[model samples]
Target: MQDEVDAVQRILSALADVGLDSITFVAEMSSTGRSVLHLLTFGPAVEAGIGPYPGSLILVEGAVPEPWRRRPHPVPRAAPAASVDAALLERTLRERIPDATGATEAEIAAAEAWLGVALPDELKALYRVTRGRWQDWGDDYAAAERVAQAVGCELFPLDELYVASALSRPCPWRFAATEAVVSPPDAAVQGLVGSPGWIVFGDNGGGDRIAVDLTPGPRGHVGQIIMLDHEQNIGASLLADSLTNLVVHQRGDRQSSYRVDQPTAVARVNIQSMTSIQAAAHPGLEVLSIGVWDGEPLSLAPVTGLPRLRTLTAYPGTLADPLEIAKLSGLEYLELGPEEWRVLLDAGAVPRTLSAAGIEVHGNRHPLPIVALANELLALWDRPPISQTILEGHVEV
Candidate 1:
């Protein structure tokens, strides 16, 4: 690892020699026989299927990843349950694991006090049967497996129970801005990265979490079991109506599935998605990403004056007029090539409305100009500038 770090320092030093402070490496599964982690899985992977912190983390230091900055748009909870059949749930667990020991009433109350919310009676009943700690089962794998099978998930301990706060799941800016939280009118589970009301109490064997949904969707029952997929950065799926249903019935509808490809919410004017910016234009469009184009440079006139367009990411030389970006009044995030940024900076056309921006460096570009441009954008917001630490040394390849 130290050798690898040294090599990176050497590369960065070489880049600095060419007036560059940072670079983003591309990932591919092509001619090279060697396999490296790319936009696909190898081991632990980014939920968005992108290389971690893609588009260069080096220069974006002062900028916080968008996820930590994101606020969950308000989601009104459905009415609470009149009551839960705690006795039935307790009977069911005892039948499944006859020797299981449960959490004390005091322990459960302590958890509620720590989380600042009363847990449903159904959840409390489950804990009363088995605390679900490894220590409770000791080194007996069979005992642990029996409990997991009985509960339909590997349960978290009473002390470990936590509110799956949305702030807990932070993603890079490029990805966080692209996702949308969707809970259909008839859905049982609400789509969100995290929620204070989601009392996470178990795991689905994989990294995905199993939680008791205190804030359910319009059609949902309070205290329904939900699974938050680890591979996804947002939302969850309905697993069961309650803990009793999960253990006894072993069935739960994976109720909600969210897709982010809304022409009104997100538009990709590129060869990979749609063909033209003109086609992507709409009043409700919030993000406009323009990618590789070999034909004529496109005009931003198609999307000008769009009230909801808050993000615009254009590839190098894709914009016919970078100044056209200024016409986008609601833009909070903008990413452009150095040349395009230079155009905006030179004309004093940089939007004062922006909260965060990124510089897209393509090819063997000099870092000096990009660093300078990054500083200029940071200065606009009184943000701390990107600082480069110089290291001079010869690294053995």
Candidate 2:
């Protein structure tokens, strides 16, 4: 097999030889230490080189031939020492964030008026650092979360993981950074300070399942309130409100992987995103409501041993297997969406412990069955669950 650098050269030579403009190759290491290649090319030029070039078929190649074309996972490095200017950052927020002036003041009184909480020292530092412009990796949610991490704030693990993954849909929020760990059963989800800034939990395979979401509350308190969206389209969100903390994903660049710390509070747990998993391995879990969306697997793989899960709401299209649902035990609510609902209906099975206040499926209007499926979902709700559902009366084609 060719070495990592050699593999990169081979791919680049083929692309450059054919005059393929705006094409670049991203290489990373899979957890198994195999090389993974993500070919990012667009427009019509790439069509010509298909036959004589790489071993894989066109569109975009995820993993390369022989060597697999992966790169090493980036290790944490120290951030360049920079000075913090609270006054400057506060001024920047005042100019940028609508009503941000109200969020920061010389004292807690002024700060509370804006952000609804006394500014913690760590939070203050973070806000000061990223008050105005900071580097973003394309996703709006990821950009906002990056701003939150600049200080010492942290996201609750269960919510953190789910929201990061919910962006699996073709939206700006899907830019996620992940790190996998296999610890003892007794291991808890520690390293809040150092864990990958975000975690996503949903299905990626081809079924509908419950959607998981996280809604940020006052002072980041995590007020326990869950909202369900069974449309199998809307991905959930759990964001870190500081720009100081950072996480890196396979798709990101060197600058995107750095660690930044900020301050945050455990606000009300808004079930903006909920999965079928009933419990988390870590303590301090605050659950709100359950919803459904087409994203990643909400259930745990038997090999992963994720148990003690309580609530789940997801679409079936996010996971590799359907039987992973057995891992969750305490699911009180469910919203199966369209794809998962069909599968569940076909299987003639539902979770034995399932008890939902209501059920909704998203019907689709597009030519694809999922479009009718999304539209069907709207009928189940007394009101639209999402504020922004159909953009210009045209759902994504």
Instruction: For each candidate in turn, give its C-alpha RMSD to the true structure in angstroms.
Output: 7.9, 20.8
List the candidate 1 regions with Cα displacement exceeding 4 Å. 1-84, 259-264, 391-397
Residue 31 error for model 2, in Å? 63
- Candidate 2 lDDT over residue span 308-349, tens digit each: 233443433544554555445554333444556556545644
Writing each residue's lDDT as its tens digit, candidate 1 over 95-116 gives 9999988999999999999999
Give the per-residue Cα lDDT of candidate 2 at 358.
Answer: 22
**How high is each candidate's TM-score?**
0.78, 0.22
